[model samples]
Structure formats: C-alpha cells, structure tokens
Target chain A: MSAFVSISLVYLAIYTLSAWSLNLQYGYAGIINFGWIVFQSIGAYVAATTALGSPTSGGFQTYIFGARLGFPLPLIMGTLAGAALALLLGLIILTRRIRPDFQAIIMLVVAIIAAEVVSTNTALFNGANGLSNVPQPFNGVMHLSYNNYQWFFVAFSFALCIIVYFGLEWICRSSWGRALRAMREDDILASHVGINVQALRIVVFVIGGAIAGFSGALLVEFLGTWSPDAWSFVESFVVFVSVYVGGRANNRGAIIGAFLVPVVFGTMPSFLPEFGYPGLSANLEWLVIAALWLTTFYLRPAGILPEGRFIARRTRAREQAPVMPPIAKQGSVA
Target chain B: MNLYIEAIGFGVIAASSIALGAMGFTLQFGLTNVLNVGYGATMSFGAIVAYAAHLTGMSIWLALICGGIATSGLTLLSAKTLLRVYAKRGAALFEMAMVTFGIALIVEYAIASITENNTFSLTIAIEHTHALGPIRFTDVQLALVILAVVVFILLDGFLRLTKVGTALRATAVDPDLARASGIATGRIVTIAWLLSGFLCGLAGGVFTIDILTVNAFTGDSLLSLVIVAALMGTAGSVRGAALAALLLGIATQLVSAAGASGYASAVAYGVLAVVLLARPKSVQGGLVADRVQITV
Candidate 1:
C-alpha cells in the first residue's frame, strides 16, 4: 500500500542516482568503467563506518574511520571516500593509452577482488554479514510514519537527483564535456585540438566517482543496511545494460533505461509464479538481462536516444551570400 | 618450514591450472585481438560438461575429451556466427567485450538454471603422498604439474616446427599481411579458436579436478587469475604465462599463509594493478585507440 509505494519510490530514486552517475562516466566520457559498483560500495562502506562510531569496544562490526558523524558529515565523507578511490585508480590506469578492453578488464578484476576482500575480512564492515541497524537522518526528531518516511525520502532523493541532473547536464554541455565528447569521438583529434586528453579523462572520472558516492550514500541512508550482496559484478552488468538499452550519451535515456530495466525486468520476476526452485526465478532474471543486452548490443548499439548532433544557427540571406562587388573582386584577375 | 613447503606445493598445483588457462587465453587474444571475457563462461561450460559426463559414469579421460570438444565447438560457432557479425560491422574493442560479457551472462545463467546452481564436488582419492627431500607431494598434484610441463613442451615444439603453427604465429603478428601472403586467415583463425578452446576446456576440467568442486561461477572466479597470468606473461608467450602463473600462485599462497586471508585476492589484484601501471605497453599491444573487441 502506501508503505510499499514509499519503499519503491526510495528504491527508484536511489537507482536513478546510480544510473545518472554511470551516465556521467560512460555516456559523456568514453571510459568503459565496468567496475563502477566498487565506487558505490566504497561510499556505502565509508558512510556506514563514519556513522557507527568506534568498533574498538567490539561491536557487531569493525570498520576503519569510525566517528559517529551527525548528519551532513557522513554524506560528505561518503563522497570523499568514493572520489579518493577514483583518484587512486585513475592515477594508475590513466597513465598510458591502454586498450579500452584492457582498461575494462582491470576494473572488473579490481571489483571482483574487492568484493572477495570485503566478504572475507571479518574486521572490515563485519565481513559478508555487513553493518545493519544504521540510523536514518531525522528519524529521531521527525517521528514520521513509514509512508511519510517514504514520501520524505522520495522527495529528498528527487531533489538531490534534480540538482545532480542539472549540474551534470551543465557540465556536459560545458567545455569540459565537449572535450570528453571530442575524446570519445577521436582522442587523436582531441589531442590535436590542444586538449590534454588524459587530464580531461581523470577530471571527468573523479566527477563521476563523486556522483557515484553521493548515490551510494543516498541508497544506504534509505535502506538502512549495506552488504556485499548489494553490489555484485552482475549488478554492474545490469547497470551497463540499462544505459546501453536506453541510449548511450543521453542522460534522459539513461534514466529512463535504468527505471525500465531494474524496476520492470529486475523486480517484476519476484512477483511471478514460483518456479522450479526458490532461486530458479532469480537465475532466469539474469538470463533475460543477458538476452536483452545482446539484443540491444547487436540491434541498437547506439541505444534508443543516440547522441544528438550539434547544429549551427542559420545565418541571414545577406550574411549567407558572399556579398562581394564582382568588378572589384575580379580586378586582380583582370 | 613445513608450512612453507605446503604453500609451495599448493602454489605449484595452482600454477598448473593458471598456466593452462593463460596459455589458451594469450593465444586466442594474441591472434584475434579480442579480450573474450566470455572465455571464463566457456571454461565453466566445459567443466560442467565434464562433470555431467563423470556423473553419467563416463571415463574421466573420455570426459576430458568430450569437454574439450564441446568447448572447441562452442568457441568456433560463436566466433563464426556472432563474433563475425560484429567484427564485420566494425564493433569497437570495448563493444566486443560487452558482447562477450552479455554472451557469458547468458551462458552462465543457462547453466545455473540447468544445474539449479548446486555445488557438485568431485573428490580425487589421492591419500598417498611421496616425500622428495623435506617436501611432500600428492600423486594428483605431481601428475598435474607434469601435464602442464608436457603441454608447454608440446605447444612450443608445435609452434616452432609445424607449418600450421608457423602460419598461426604469422597471422598472430599481422593478420592482414598473412592474408596478403596467401594464408587462409579465416581458416587459421578458426584453427586457433579450436586449439585455444580445447586448451581452455582442458584447463577447466583440470581446475575442477584439483578443486574437487564444480559450480557455474568457478571459471568466472578463475578468469581474473588467468588474465593476470596472461598479462604478466606479456601475451602470446606460453612460457611467460607459465612462469607468471607460478609466480602468481606462489604470491597468493604466501599472502594467505601470512594470515592476511582477506587480502589474498587483493594481493593478486594488487599485482595486476602494479603490472598495469608498470607495463602499460602490455595492455595496449601497439594499438593506441584499440577499443576492446571481444568477438567470441
């Protein structure tokens, strides 16, 4: 009922943010960041650690940077944590012009290894069980109903999304975004145009990381739990599929694609008839996604809303004409 | 000292699996210039096929052949059918990787659905161990290492001596030039796919044998380690892959033995990152703008 609507809205908003963050990276910039989820995971982990206070007293979980930060501090720290990882990774990968595929493989490997570490290290985010019972902001002061909380979250997240959307849109249309587009089309040409291709890539990458961090923070604040299950390599693919299916290089398309895939394709299966085994339906979900990915990849590689071509403004008739006196112009020839 | 010996033994055994997988991966990637992320899924498919055959009471040797053939057929079909379509359409390297990833997801999920995502264990009854000086080794481990060495020697010999192998190496270096020189580049690529696929399948089967478990995600997990080994070897060099595999296996084992259990995978990834940073050339392969193009 109303509670479900609230929860669903929160989920939708959070996923939209994640999708938008990815759009900034893969759409505007040609960087194939296959391991995008790692940034989000770091953000969630950091935000949780900061809010949980110290683990020295042997709490349920042990994590670094325990500080019980009140409100905005946790969210800010989350963004910083994600940006830090991006900077570190960018410094390493952005050094030379490696093949894009190799770059992707490296990211995928980093994410897989990262997930394994998080799951195995009991002291780090309480191992696979993850940190739970995280207190939501204003939960104590507001004393709101579950439905109200949902509405509140939906409103708050949408507000953040609007800011991010406008901010990202402005940035993409800016000189920096143009440089990214140029780089995407042809790095050599972009470089010839006096653009520092590598530097531009890193800048956009860090920005994308920041967005991812904010998205992760928003998600954790809403869900009240963070675990390894929340971020899987397959989940990364799901996001990629959404972006690709919706339209590459189109923010609106990306948002629409994200909503359609995660909500319709990903969530709808749960409500269907019980399959062979309990998890069979879940397994089939991935199969459908794969089929959808391949279909889109082959049929519409450019996506539904492809990158729009920039057109120049029309000039007046007089301006369009050469507007030269024929005698004066032919004097030299005569 | 015994613990160190045990780690070394395990490292050697693990290295055999990586070596086989890496050699196949390097060869396929070298010639095709495709990352082939679906390779791990194909490996898993091979392992499952072998496991199913074993469950059906087939001889282990026959199961190995069946798995190898099955993987080879799948690889060839994928390369000829789907990959060729994209390649013909001039898909970027990254786009190809995406395609392969999609294919892998499909294959893996299909297998998961079929198997019900159950973990099947295949225990090797190798209780007997032989002591060589201060180190002890199991029969299966010894056999695996020996098999890896034999594969290395045979592959090296083939590449150096045979006409087909010479054509493969020529094509690997320059497909267009090889084609201009009247070599059937298509046939060569197909043969490469078949051989590499067979080797990948064998690696998968051996991996399951060593781990004594078969699961859909087994090859997916092993893919990174194999890539590390392949990349470390500088790609296209079988000997280098084997040596790198040995190093990686030893390094991971040592890290785990040092009580840094959680960071062991991280340690391996750390090596990959270092290699990436240190040797960017290995990743680029002379193509500055080469987007990942994984056909099969």
Candidate 2:
C-alpha cells in the first residue's frame, strides 16, 4: 500500500508536469499540439538509451544509439532531444500560416507516423516490445531499500514539479505570456502589434517540449521501462483532456486537472475488483475518460477553475485615472 | 519493371478504397467545416456492423449496404444532435474537431470492450483471380474497383445534375448565401452527412474486404491515408480526391515494394507535409480565424 501510494504520487507529479507543459502550448499559446505525446516518448527513449549503455548484438533489446551517461546527463540529453524535435517540427509547422485545424491534423499525423516508425524499426527502439531495463538514477549509490527508494523518487519528482509549477507561473504572468494570449486570440492582430508571433510560437513550443521531455525522463527513471504502448497518440489526448478539465491558461488548474484525471480517475479502475473480461476494464476506462471529456466541454467549457482575469497594476491605474475623454466625442457628435 | 507494375496494380485496388473514404471526408468537411476525426471510428463501427450482418447469413453485398445505412443514420443523428449541441455552445472549428475526437474515443472503446479487444478475421471466398498485364486481382478486389468507379460516376452525376446537389455546392461555398437564395441549408447539410456517411461506411467495408480483417481500430489505422488523400485533393472536389487517392495509393505501394513496407504510409504523409510546406496557399490558405463556422 505504501508502494502504491509512492508510485501514485510520482505519477501525479509526472502527469501534472505534462499537463502544465501542454497547457503552456495549447491553452496559452493557442498552438494545438495534437502530437504532444511524441515529444514525451522521444524524451523517454533518449533517456533510456543514454542510460542503458551499449546494446549487445543479440541482447534482449536493440536501440539505435547507446551511452553510459551519468544520471544528470541522461536527463539533460532527454530534455535537449525533446527541444530539438520541437524546434524541427515548429519550423515545419509554424513557419507557414496554415489554418489551425490543418496544423493540428499535421501534428496528429506526425504522432501516428512517429509511433509507427518507432514500433516497426526494431533497431531503433527494439520494435513493439520497446526498451526495458533502463537503469534507475542513484540506485547503486544510495543503497536504499526498494520501498524507501520509491519514496525518495516520489519526493524528487514532486520537488521538480514544484519548481516547474513556479517557473511556469512566473512565465505565464510575464509580458511574454500576455503576448501568447494575444497571439492565441488573434495572431494577425498580434503581429500587427509587433509581437513576432512566429518566433514566440516556436519558442513557447520548445519550452513546452523541454518540460515534457523532463517529465518523461523522470517517469522512465522511476519505472525503468519505456514502450510504444506507454505513449500512444491517444495518450496525448489524455493530457489535452486534463488541461481542458483543469482549466486552460491556469497553472493551478493544470495541477488540479492532472491530479483529478490522470492520477485519480486513471488509477481508480485498477483498485476495483475484476468483474468483466481482462481488457474490459481498460476499455471502459477509456470510454469514461472520453465521455468525461465531452461532458467537460459541454457542462464547463471554461473548466472547473477558469482562468482569472489578470489586470496589471498599470492597467488598473489607467482605468482608475478620471474619465476626460468626452470632449472630442461630444464635439464630433454635434 | 514487373515488380513496379505489380505494385501499380495493387495501388489501383488500394486507391479505390481510399478514394471512397476521401471523397466522403472532403465533401462533408468542405460543407460542414468540421474535421470530424470520429469519421474513422464511424467507419470501423460500420465495418463491424457489416460483419455482424454477414454472420446473420446476409449476402456480403447486402451486408455492406446495411453497414452503409447504419453509419448514415449514425452520422445524421450525431450531426443533428451531438454536433449541433457543441456548435450551439460556441465551439470553434478546432474545438469541434476535439469534440469529434472525444466521440471517436467513446465509440472505439465501446467497440473494443464489446469485442473483447480481439481482432476478427473476415473471410470471403474468392471465386477467381483476374490478371491484367503484370497485376493480379481476386474477384473481391475487382468488385471493389467496379464499386468505386460506379459510385464515383453516380456521385458525379448527382453533384452535376441535381438541384439539391447544386444547393449542397452552394451551401458548401457560403451557408448564409445559400439560405438567402431560398435553399434550406439545414436539409442540405443533413443530406451531406448521410451521403458522406454512406460513402465512408462503404469505404470501410471495401477496406475490410481488401485487408481480410476487422477490428475496432482498423478504420482508424486507415484514417491517416484517407485524410492524406482528402487534403491532397481540393476540398469538395470529388475528381480531385479520386486523383489524389490514386496518386497516394500508388506512392504507398511503390514505397512498400521498395522493401520498406512499414514506412509506406509515412512516405505518403511526407508528400502531404511537403505540399503543405511548399505551397501553403494551395493546400491550406492563410489563417482565417473564426471564418469557418461549424454548420452542423
């Protein structure tokens, strides 16, 4: 029970990080990244390969490249991998002024193709079986009991989450975050106002991708496995749903959403007694998630905790400053 | 050379299935302005329904019709009820797409749970094999090709000749204007949904026949190709969709024949990506925010 509690805490932290990253991209920036899971999966694969060292010729798993990197280095490389991929995709997707829906479909297609490529190219990530036996960070040096280590990892993950949460809060409340909202509402107008919409979009995309990568690395280090099944395209939707349910453009909502959706509702089924066939519960879980998504959209489009209006101090001062603007309007009307 | 020819032959068969689905997708998307990602799930549902009909001792052809009709009703009902609810609630184009995706998940998992997550093999006895030059096709494949051609002709005729078809075209172009011109836009949209849904279902049946397998995810797996074909073609242009489908079908088969069967679909998607990158104006014009109102 303690192990379960620790693992659930870790998952909650990881999912919260993912939801925050996605909220940064879609909720704030208005970039509908339908292929969000690919970024996370890429991060996991990179971290696993880097930490797993070299693969033997007839070993249990085969990957494209391997290295015996130290703990921090693998995580850093994973983050970089995600950022680089986001850069590549952003250049392709955001460089042009395609319709938002078209951009989304492209991202979805990319996710699907990436999954297919990774699963089919056995040399890349050991085919559908995926890369397993990923080395845990600090496992050998700590010499702690397994349960104690789990708690340690959970604490480590939650610490990172707090850091990310505050970092995202700082960013979202900045002038640049306001620029993202402007772009999301109207890019043409935002560009007219000299916001450099394209550049801002790419930058935000990279940042979100890095965060997603970091979360993926942390999760893989704890679980010690990464597979295609773990990060399917549908998983991206799960995060999207979390962001939607939690409240778009609100970091606290993202955390709440991650806890409620992926952490609570996602794990609730496992605790129930097995009544139906083996896979029925899993399918039913997905069905309920999808239904909940629709219900959220219908009942609470603004989410449980909608984004609060952010009135800057200067704006408030300007609004409060005495209304002396009727002179020209009265003259014009006369 | 023979290998390439054989690939081309197989490409024709694949194109028939793709064209059917792409045509329906493009037509409805152009008219309704909803991406309808649930389309693939609806196709899967239709195929499963057809399989069930076949199990009930119905002829395969009749079963296909049943599947098409069932999907048509489902599509119409969803459009009239579920989609309309979202649209009325002010969901934009992207949000509507997300809604459809949610619907897709519900339907897909429902099917998965009912089927026990098992893939069912579809068996239809092939009477004979027909050879054309270096290409060989079974009877079923030949029938599918003929079915595609016949549907295309009928659809083309309907779109070109009928007044309702003209209304559909007009509504697709401008809904308010079509209404101003005394066309009942609502009825036309209903027709669009039903017709497109039927085509989508038929495509699923033909695809199942080609692959000889049925599963909850089968249509979704084929959806990328369908979307590729639909986007490659001009929206609402049946001929363009058919031509694009043919092109993609041949490209995928040739790529597979070149020994990288796994990346065949990727190659087709690459073409779309390149098209999108090179000529965004031709494929998807500059961002028109809120210009496309969901018409469901």
Candidate 3:
C-alpha cells in the first residue's frame, strides 16, 4: 500500500506537468495537438537510449546512442529530443494556411504513422519490445532502500511539478500568453491587432512540447522502463480529455484534471475486484472515459474548473480611485 | 519481375477495397461537409456484423449485404442523433471531428467488449487462379476488382443521370440554393446518407475479407490509410478518390515488396504529409470557411 501510494504520487506529479504543457497549447493557444503522446514517447525513448548506453548487438538489448551519460544529462537530452520534434512538426503544421480540423487530422495521422514506424523498425528503439532497465536518478550514490527511493523520487517529481506549475502560470499571465489567447479566440482579430499568429503558435508549440518531453523524462527515471505500448494515440486522447475535464487555460485546473483523471479514475479500475473477465475493467476504463468526455462536452465544455476571467490591473485598482486615481489616470492618459 | 507483378496484383485488390471506402467517404464529406473520423469505426462495425451473420449460417454474400445495411443504418443513426445534435449547438468543424472520435471510441470498444477483444480469423476459400502476362489473381480478387468498377460506374451514372442525383450534386454545391430552388434538400440528404453508408459498409466488408481478419481495432487502424486516400482525392470527387486509393495502395505494396514491409504505411503517410504540406489550400476550399450542414 505504501509503495502504491508513493508510485501514485509520482505519477500524479508527472501527469500534472504534462497537463500544464497541454493546457498551454490547447487551452491558451487553441492548438489541438492530437499527436501529443508521440512527444512524450520521444522523451522516453531518447532518455532510455541516452541512459542505457547503446545496444549490444550480441548482448541483451539494442538501441542507438550507447553512451550511458548518468542522471540529469539523459533527462536533458530527452527534453532536447522533444523540443527538436516539436520544432520540426510545428514548422510543418503551424507555418501553413490550414484549418484547425485539418491540423488535427495531420497530427492524428502523424501519431498513428509514428507508432507503426517505431514498432516496425527493430533496430531503432528495440522495435515494439522497448528499452527496459533504465537507470534511476542517483541510483549509484543513493544507498536508500527501494521504498525509500520511491518516496524520494515522488518528492523529486512533485518539486518539479511545483516548478512547472509556476512556469505555466508565468506563461499564462505573460503578454505572450495573452497573444496566444487572442489568436485562439479570433486569429483574424489577433492579426489585425499586429500579433504574429504563426510565429507565436510555433513558439508555444515548442514550449509545450519541451514540457511534455521533460515530464516524460521525469516519469521514465522513476518507472525505470519505457516502451511503445506505454504511449498510444489513445493515450494522447486521454490527456486531452483530462485537460477538458479539468479546465483548459488554468494551471490549477490542469493539476485538478491530471489528478482526477489519470491518478484517480485511471488507477481506480485497476484496484477493483475482477468483474466479467481479465480485460473487462481495462475496456470499461476507456468506455467510462469516453462517457466522461462526452458528458463534459455536453454538460460543461469549460470543464470543472473553467478558465478564470482576466481582471485588468487598472480596473482592479479602481475601487481606491475615488480620491486619487481620476486625476492621476487622466494626467497619465493625457 | 514476377514479384513486382504479384505485388501489383495484390495492390490492385487492396486498392479496390480502399477505393470503395474512399468513394463513400467523399460522397458523405462533400455532401454533408463533415469530415466524419468515425467512418473507419463504422466500417469495422459493419465487417464484424457481417462476420457474425456468416457464423449464423448466412452465405458470405448475404453476410456482406447484412453488414452493409447495418452499417448504413448505424451511420445514419449517428448522423441524425449525435452529429446533428452537436452541430445544432454551434460546434465548429474541428469540435465536430472530436465529437465523432468520441462516438468512434464507444462503437469500437463496444464491439471489442462483445468480441472479447480477440482477433477473429476470416478465411474464404480461394477459387482457381488465373494468369495474364505477368499478373495472377484468384477469382475472388478479380471479383472484388470488378465489384469496385461496377460500384463506381453505377454511382457515376446515378449522379450524372438522375434528378435526385442532380439535387444531391446541387446540394453538395450549395444547400441553401437548392432549398431556394424548391428541392427538398432534407430528403436528398437522407438519400445521400443511405447511399454513402451503403458504400461505406460494403467497403468495410470487402476490407475485412481482403485482410482475412476482424478485430475491434482493425477499423481504427485502417482509418488513416482510408483518410489518406479520401483526402488525396479532391474532397468530393469519387473518381479522384478512387484514383488516389490506387496510388496509395500500389505505392505501399511496391515499397513493402522491396523488403521493407514495416515502413510501408509510413511511406504512404509520408506522401500524404508531403502532398498536404504542398497543397494546403486544396483542403481548406477557401478562406471563408463555408460548409453546408446536412439536416438529415
């Protein structure tokens, strides 16, 4: 029970980090990244490859980049891998004259095709079997017990989550964040207002992709395994449902969503007693998710914790303006 | 050379199935203006329904018919019930696609739950093989090719010759104008649904038989390939879609035959990505975002 609690906390933190990234993209930027899982998978694969120290053809496992550059480095490389992919895909997808639906289709196709390619190419990323026995962070130096290590990792992940949460908050309140929202709401109007819609889109897409990568890197370090099976196109959709349920443009909403969806609902079915068959609960989990997604769309499209209305600072200080603000503001305005 | 020829034969057969689905998709998309991502799910559902019918002692041909009808009904039902409901609420094109994905998940997993998530094998006895020059094929493959040709011809004739087809064409071009011209665009839309659904169902049945397997995820898997074909062909052009299917089918098969079977799907997607990136304007129709919603 304690072990499970520790693992769940780690996953919760990881998922929150992911949700924050996705919120930045879909919630604020209005880019529906249907291929979001691929970014995470990229992070995991790169981290595994970099840390596993290359493949022994006549040995146990095979992968590229055999240099096992201990902790933090692998994680950094993973983040860079993610950013690289995002940069490429964003250029292909965002620097174009296309509809949002078309963008979604393109991303969806990319995700599906990517899975097929990764699974088929046996030499690259060990095909579908995936790379396992990944080195844990500071496993060599830390002489901690297994469960204690788990707790430490959980704390480490949560710390990263707090950092990411603040980062997303900073982006959300930034002028650039306002630009993203403006473009999302009305691209035409945003353009009219002199916002570089395409460039802004690419920037946010890369940022979100980086965050997704970082989250995946953190996740794999704790779990010590990475595989194609871990992330599917459906996994991408599931995250989208999380953001939708939690609320799009809000970091607090992302935390709430990540915890509620993956941490609570996703984990709940596993703990339930056997019902009809072995895979019944697994299938039911997806079915229930779809139902929840549809219900959210119908009942509360803004999700449980909708984006809070922005309050301008000037308007916020107007309550004390009865004596000093009118003349000072008028003088400044003049 | 013989291997190349054999791959071409298989490619043509595969193209027949893909073309059938693409045609139906083009018709629905062009007329209704909704890119129904659930089309693939519906296709799989139809195939499964047909397979069940076959197990229950229906002839293969009869099962095919049953599957087609069931799929059509299901497609119409979804369009009328779910899609229409969402569209009425001012859901944009992208939002509608997302909604259809939700429907697809339910439909696919429902089948998965029923079938116990096991992949069912489908084997129909292959009749005598015939050879002409470097090409060889079973009677069933020849028959499938013929079926595709016949479907296209009949559909072309109906759309070109019939008054209702004219209304469909007109409605596809502009629904409001058709209504102004006193054509009951609503009834035409119902007919369009039936026709497109039938083709979609037929395509599903054909695809399952060609692949010789059926599973809940099969339709979803085939969705991207079918979309690649449908989109490559102009949005509503049947001939264009059929041609695109042939191109994709042949390209993937030839590449697979060249000893890289796994990258074959990727190769096809690579082509789609390139074409889409090159010709973004073709998909958008115009900058105005004009789309005619189907009442049926």
Candidate 4:
C-alpha cells in the first residue's frame, strides 16, 4: 500500500480512539468535556519532549522537564500526564452542582485558556514553535524503510485501538454504565438512588482523559513532531461531532462515526478541486463538517447507526416463558 | 502605582464593552436558556454591518445603531427559526448549545468566505483627550463609556419599570406560569430578543471601535470573555452581570499591565473555575437543579 493510505489508516485509528473516549464521557456519563483537545495536546507534548531528551536550551527549543527516556516509558508518561491533568480539573468540575450547560461552557473556557497559556508560556512547551524531530519507536530495531515503518505504526495503532475498544466495551456493558445512563437522565435522582454521581463522573472523566492522551501519544510518535498548533479548542468539537453523529451511547457508532467524519471526510479535502487558493479547501473542509453536523441533527438525530437497546439475559428457560393472570368475571361486583 | 492606575483606566474602557455584550448575553440566556453560542456569529455579523456603514461614510453613532438593528433582526431570526425548531424537538440544553454552535460555524465561515478572511481596521476619529488625575481618555473611549452607562440605565428601567419588563421577569422565572397569567409571554420573549439583540450589536460596534480592528473571527474570539462575565454574574441578573463584567475587565487589564498579555483574557476563565471550585452550592443555587427551558 502507498504511504498515503498507511497514514490515513493511522489517523483513522487515532481518531477512533479519541471518539470512543469522548463518547464514553459525553454519551454515557453526560460530562460535557469541551476541553478534551487540550488533554490530547498534553499527551503529545509529554510524549514528544520525553522522547526528544533534554532540550539544549540556548541551542534550539526552550521547554521545561526535558529527559531522555525509552519509547514505552514516554508513551506511559504521556498517558499519565493526560490522566493527571484530567484528575486535577475533574476534581473541581465534577464536584460542582452546576447545570450541564454551565459545565459545557466552563470546559470551553478551559480549552481556550489552555491554548493561550501553552502558547504564551514558551518555557513550558517551547511556546508556539513547538517540538519537532521526535524519535519514532522501533526506528532502528525494525530496520524498515520509512514508508514501511508507517505501515508498521499503523498496524500497531490498530492493535491498540482493538484493545481499547474491547476494554471500553466491557466497561460500558457493566453496572457502571447503567448508573452513568441514570445520571445522564437526572443528576438529582441519580444521587437520590445512592449513586455517588460526583465520584462516578470524576472516574469516567479521568479514564476518558487517559484514553485521549494515549491516542495523542500514539499520534505524535507516528508523526515525529508536536506543536501547540496541532490542538485547538475547536478540534474538541470535531471529536464531539464524531461521537454524537455516530451515536451518543454506542461504541460501534463512535468507531464508525469517527471513520465516517474525521477519517473519510478529513481526507476527502485532498481529492476536491482547488477553488480559490491553497487553504480554501481546508476552510471548506470545516464548512462541510459544520454542514454535516447541522444536517445530522436535522435528519437523523439518533445517528445513522443508533445505539442498541440493552437488555439483561435470563438464566433459565422457565424465566423466559410468558404467563397470563386470571381475569375477574364482569358480574362479580362485590 | 502609575501603571496600575493606567491599567484601571483601560480596564474600565474594556469593561464598558464587555458589560454591554454580557448584559445582552445574560438577558437572552436568562430568558431563553439556549446558551446561544451562535451569539458570537451574530455579534460579528452586526459588527460587519457597522463596518459597511462606516465605509459608506456614516458617523460612528449611526453605525452603532445600524449594527444594533441588524443584529437584533438576526437574533430574532435565529431564535425563531433555528433555536425554536430544536427546542420544539425537545432538545436538551447541551443539544441546543450544539445546534447553536453549528449555526455559529456556518455564520463565521460564511463571513470568512465573503471577507476572504482579512482583518479590517476600524477608524475612530479621536479628536481630543480629556485628563483627570492619573488617567487620560480619548473622546471615542468616553463616548463608549457613556454608551454603556446609558444602555444599562435603559435596560434596567426597561426590565424593572415597565409592564412588559415585569412580564419578561415572570417569563424568565417560569414560562408556563407567565403564560397562564395572561402575560402574552410570546410577545415579551420577542421583545427580549429585540432588546438583547440590540445590545449584542451595539456591543459589537463598541468593541470594534475600542479594539481598533474588526474581522470575521472577532466576535467568536471575544465570546469566551463575554460568557465568563455572564455566567459569573448569575445569568438572569443584569446588575450582577454588569458588576461581574467590571471586575473581569479590571482583572484582565491588571494582568496585561503586569506583562503577561497573552494570559490576560484568561483571567475571566480563571475567575469562573475558581468560583466553581470554591462555592458549588451557591453556584448551583443550593442543590436545587432548575431545568432551563429553551423556548420563550
């Protein structure tokens, strides 16, 4: 396969993971994490900086906490960084008794704030210039051509995607997910039912944050570069558009929706005839995505592939059998 | 000491613009419960209208009125067409926000496509400067402050002293109750939309003049700050929003004066997050979750 196709597959896998994490949060848990992209940026920065070793300071880029680490360690560190950030923010956000709309706006504010802070405090993550020349995993061990290395990474990403997919699927099918649905329906009622709503939201948020970070780590490692420009607050909306357009509560819907929106539509801009200028297609791409979002809400609010109904299994055949009760005679009015 | 005083001066100017926008935002949000993210787009469109008027040699005051009228129409159109449709479908608060966001994207991008994404400078002819104590102000800035104060008095009086205003307050608190009380809740809502839309557009025009630049991306970028003020002030209270806007403005100006200019606008968000963390019950109104209706 061509390098282009391999690159596309890798993106598909990465976005699929992101969509899944966001889906779990917004879909099941009803935590509107509008700042989701910033967490991914954290993972990318941590992964890239750790893999790149110490910054030479005056020699080139400027950043804090530069250390030379092995491939797996950087990836692990990236995931941890994402979780740490989420754990910190979720502590405050989840504990609040605010409405969902308020929560969404707060998250939005955080997303914008994170971008400005990161770009402004250049010493933290090398500012707007960002980090480049990040080392790729198995670069020497595999001894493969660059194009083939991409294919390898794509396969690796897909494998990780499968693991995460099954893991999240298992969790969603558990009692925790049922509780999450209840909370989404009514927070006060959920708390009344003895469910620790705040604690559950925090748990789900952190887990989702970790997944987002992992995907970011995988993506940066594959690309061998990281930048503040890579993640914008609006990008979170794109991930949201995917999860929502796919199916709010369905994992399969998330995967398919990710593929359909980010994977397919994202790459389609390349095939479009150039209109006015070079960046025109890119502009039009976002426009199309926006149109797609509006169209989906109008036509199929339940998504193309709606969520499946969850029904618990019966253990015995007798339990599955239907029964009818005896009716009272019309004349027997005591 | 001198820079601190100077920053306070700038903060007041910033606050004036922010206050106008926040007042409008809080008004619509308090009554409609749409959390209309597309407000940013409407603001930009309004500013654009003002910009067009200025190009045609209209005075700054006329431009503001023109923009305000245009924005009011746009706001009502959006509320009636887009937001009402979704609300009718029983879309929840967050879903309504998503719909508004989609509308915002369309408006912002269409402007971008039309304007070709170019930044246009707003010309404010500041003829003279008046100085008092350690502060100095251009005539344009003075006019803005006056505009803000006048709008506030008018809106406050409109919301308090009039029968429609009473009806609006009633509708805001409980739409069904207001409807049952023979209040013509629909007309009051339409009036709210008009008044808020005017404020929204007026704010846009004032912001462009104050900042000295206008662009397709202008309103959306300023939106976060506006929202922070509106939310922090308590959604339905105009006085609360105005005071919050003033505080935010001062904080941002002080931050910028301290040299971290990029993080200045972020102060509003910091205030919000800190407030949320500090007082959950107060912020959530003591554990009573009010389901906000998106319709009039």
For model 2, chain A alone compared with the true chain A gives a TM-score of 0.93
Off by over 4 Å in 2: A316-334, B282-288
Tell me, what's the RMSD of every candidate?
Answer: 3.8, 3.6, 3.7, 3.4
DockQ per candidate: 0.58, 0.61, 0.48, 0.45
Judged by lDDT against the true structure, how good is candidate 1?
Answer: 0.82
Report the C-alpha lDDT of model 3 over B1-296, residue by residue, as the tens digit. 88888888889998988898999988888888788888888999988988999999998878988988999999999888888887887777766887888888889888889888899998889869999777887888888899999999999889889998888999988888899999998898888888888888888888888888998877765677788888888777888899999988888899989999888888888888777878876765321133435344
Question: Rank by DockQ, descending?
Answer: 2, 1, 3, 4
| Fnat of every candidate, listed in order | 0.67, 0.65, 0.46, 0.45
- The runs of at least 3 residues in candidate 1 whose Cα sits more than 4 Å from the true structure, single-residue gaps closed, are A1-4, A271-273, A311-334, B285-288, B291-296
Which residue pairs show collisions in model 1? Answer: B93-B291, B93-B292, B93-B293, B94-B292
TM-score of each: 0.93, 0.96, 0.94, 0.94
Model 2 per-residue lDDT tens digits across residues A115-140: 88998899999989998999999999
**Would you list the clashing residue pairs of candidate 3?**
A53-A66, A54-A66
Clashing pairs in 2: none
Per-model lDDT: 0.82, 0.89, 0.84, 0.85
The Cα error of candidate 2 at residue A284, in Å, is 0.3
lDDT of 3 at A241: 81
How close to the true structure is residue A301 of candidate 1, measured as C-alpha lDDT? 80
Model 4 lDDT per residue over B71-141, tens place: 99988898888778878877878788988898888888888888887889976767999997788999999
The share of true interface contacts that also appear in candidate 1 amounts to 0.67
Q: Candidate 3 chain B, which ten residues in sequence have the lowest lDDT sum?
A: B285-294
Task: Give every candidate's TM-score on chain A.
Answer: 0.90, 0.93, 0.93, 0.93
Q: Candidate 1 or 3, higher TM-score? A: 3
